[model samples]
Target: MDNNLTDRSFWKAFWESRIGLIFNIKRDYIFGDMLGKIKAKKGYQTAIELGGFPGYYTIYLKKYENMDTTLFDYFVHQGLVNELLEVNGLKETDIDIIEADLFSYQPETQYDMVLSFGLIEHFKDTKAIIATHLPFLKDNGTLFITLPNFKSINGWVQRKFDLENYNKHYIESMNPALLASYCKELGLKDVESYYHGKFSMWLENKGTQSALAKAFVKSLWFTGKVFTKIFPFESKALSPYIVLKATK
Candidate 1:
């Protein structure tokens, strides 16, 4: 590869690593509630995250439940995942960090909870997700998911283009109803969807037609809490990201 391409590749990897680790480590409190939902049913012992970006969620879950879990992903973002683990004072053996694409890896056992946040929407084949991802769930297990929604104009445009790369994910925005169907297909019951903060919620509206789109999004982000109070479920009303809590 040329220096430019190499540089881009390195930065891309670095970006994924750093953001994956530092960003969004905090529990998707909206989604994390599903962990409790799962515990109400089967109870978890061994939990695994398929596309753990920087091990933020991995470490968070470990600390939250005192879990000795597994983190799996190819670590395409330089060595960000590995670096984060070490920085967090986690030893190599402390986690089963699989630097491999999850599509090819299969597990021999089942788990009590299966989490794939910000992951499912990347693929087009929802069936593959059910095949590879949900099986980790033990009976009555809980599976938590977040995917991009196409309810707005920007998301619609992204989904309309050459989206083959995200064939395994949403690559497009999503409809909660459709996602609920997928959860049902996974044999999960009591499926519920949630969104965070008001900014993301306002973005969910099909208000992309407004010329002041950028300004509108900014206002929503800055004052989403106010908006949420005035318009709860506004996240679902405006944005594409939704948290699904389903039981098997």
Candidate 2:
């Protein structure tokens, strides 16, 4: 993900659409996983979502739990926010919405948790992105990030059998160890990272794909789903997503 390409407008459209290869939903498993992490730590009163578009994750956090939430993203996608509010039968009083480029915006107050999913991987400087958010989190706050694990077995399967599904925006695939090192260098404490999501998820969330791609995902959908049910365990090194969290 090149910086030049990650302009506000592109992301605005990306949130509204599922036309491109990279426009993937933050799948249910990943959201649930994040919620579990937040609950485990037990201090989720105030939270902000960086690059939160369509604002589903923020909505989920607010709806299921008690939290003061803010969603930051480009202004062009404000309509999507409104739509989400209406669809969820929520009101503006529920959460604050800020429309601005993620890098330029500054928070007036720090939060208990700062979250971003499929965000840092798009940039060349992952550390810089994380660093920018540090000032916005309260002391002992949690920083949570999730990225597509392109180094995993599911990644290999996509590249081999579904090239269109593998896009260039994934400039790099990061592991838990790599994420831990970054957090350490940045002075973040209690760092933890690992894999999430089974192949079955990839099969079900093939959004707006071409006929050929749809057929391909469908062909193996049953097998993948069954495999997960039988195994009932996610492989740390082979899952589809890498989840990272640390405290500041």
Candidate 3:
């Protein structure tokens, strides 16, 4: 882990850049909603975020919710940890840092929420990937999962523009429905799915694209927003990402 990544100077620079803007949008739209639901529920005590590198979402949740938080990742990015703590006005003791792989790791106790983002899609066995986390959740605990939906128009655009890490995704057909089915198979009740992230937000984070490509994306921003506003239902269906909320 690069210390520079968490250093206040580097964070300040990135926070002022377009990538930071994208991150803020993602956090607000994704984490904000999910954490709101978590806090709304009864008996919400602790949350454990798997694959929480840099823990941006975890940090945000910690700021609002009065619960014990834990971050589990195979590799520890100390810079991200420090940056999150400092930015969120949290201390080292405020959150637990665990260095462990999900496959072989088991918790001594369960949490009120077991969360993971952009994780299960990387493995061939998505079922087992999710099942592995079951033991870490308390009875009636919520399991939240978010992944890139490669079946939408946003997916086609990302592919056409070569803006995604295709090789990193084990399957091309990942969607909320498929994930919901997995939860059902595992006997998880009250499953729900949502689509989020329009083209403009996706393009904003694609900071490495060519100048002409960026200009093309910029042109579509207003049109996309207008289309989404007029056809909100359709827009959600064509959104770039999927989030699954289920009870264990």
Residue lDDT tens for model 1, 58-144: 666665566667776645453665576666656556666655656666677677677777666555565565556766677777777
- Where model 2 places Cα greater than 4 Å from the true spot, the runs are 1-5, 19-30, 33-37, 157-165, 201-212
Residue 199 of model 1, lDDT score: 40
Give the alpha-carbon lDDT of every model: 0.58, 0.70, 0.70
Which pairs of residues have clashing backbones in candidate 2? none
For model 2, what is the C-alpha lDDT against the true structure? Answer: 0.70
Clash counts per candidate, in order, are 20, 0, 0
Q: Write the per-residue lDDT of candidate 3 for residues 1-248, one digit (tens) a residue.
A: 12111233433443445233223323454557757766686668788888766676666667766678888876665765776587667777788888876777868879989888877776777778888879998889999888777666655556667644454465543766777888899999999977766543354346678898888766766677788787766344467677888898
Residue 199's lDDT in candidate 3 = 40
Alpha-carbon TM-score of each model against the true structure = 0.69, 0.82, 0.81
Q: Give a tens-digit lDDT track for model 2, residues 165-242.
A: 455345454667877788899999999888777654363135546788777666666667777888766675446777
